[model samples]
Target: MNIAEVSKKYEISADTLRYYERIGLIPEVNRNKSGIRDYTEEDCRWVEFIKCMRSAGLPIEILIEYVTLFQQGNETIEARKDLLIEQRKQLIEKMENVKKTIERLDYKIERYEQSVVTKENELKRTDD
Candidate 1:
């Protein structure tokens, strides 16, 4: 597939895909004779993996490191596993923080609703 096709299929912009390639976030893409990117299945898989990792809030620097490790062959398997484990820990912490914030927001919203109801009831009593 071409750059545009890969961009549409992945729901990512072509510029972003180019940037990812330039930044080494994804592996190098093969270009056609005309210098247009021709994404092979392997390239597309890397794009999908990068997109998923990015959407999960993984930092670009970490991804670059992971890609570097990946390029170094299978000997870095343990190191890659360690990196993923660390990233997972960070994501879990962020999730816990988000859960707490959601609970706080819910409580505040409930309080506001109760206040509104109490004020409405008071106005009704006064009009009676």
Candidate 2:
């Protein structure tokens, strides 16, 4: 597919895709005879993987190192696994913090709602 199609399909900007390619965050994308990008299934898979990792809050520097290790062939398998495991641990911690934040927000919102209801009820009693 063309860059535009890939962009729409992946919900990413074409410029961002080019930037990923330029920065080696993704492997090189093949271009047609006209020098336009033609995304293969493998390339698309890389794009999807990068996007997913990015959405999960993985740092670009870490991803770049991961991709570099991935390109080094089979010898780096163990190292890559270790890297992923470490990143997963970080992501889990981040998720826990986010959950705590959500709970705090919920508590605050509930308090505000209760206060509003109490004031409304008090106003109604005064009007009665």
Candidate 3:
């Protein structure tokens, strides 16, 4: 597949893919005779994994480290696992904080609505 096809399959922009490559977040892709990117199944799989990690809010610096470790082969397996575990813990904490924020916002919105209704009722009574 080409870069465009990979981007379409992953729902990421071509610039993002290029940036990932440039930033060492992904391995260098092969090029065809025309110097265009030639993506293989392995590349596609890597892109999908990267996308999943990114969607889960993994930091780009960590991702670049992960990719570097991956390129270093099996000796870094334990280190890679540790990175993922740490990131997972952080993501979980972030999700909890977001939930708390959402709950607070919901409460505030409900209180505001109630206040509006009460004011409208008072106005109606005064007008009558």
lDDT tens digits by residue: candidate 1, 77-127: 999999999999999999999999999999999999999999999999999
Model 1's lDDT to the true fold?
0.98
Model 3 lDDT at residue 36: 98
Q: Order of candidates by lDDT, top first?
A: 1, 2, 3
Please provide, for model 2 over 18-89, each residue's C-alpha lDDT reduced to its tens digit, 9 standing for 90 to 100: 999999999999899999999999999999999999999999999999999999999999999999999999
For model 1, give the 10-residue run with minimal summed lDDT.
23-32
The residue-by-residue lDDT of candidate 3 on 9-127, one tens digit each, is 99999999999989988899999999999999898888999999999888899999999999999999999999989998999999999999999999999999999999999999999
What TM-score against the true fold does each predicted structure earn?
Answer: 0.97, 0.97, 0.92
Identify the runs in model 1 with alpha carbons over 4 angstroms from their true place: none
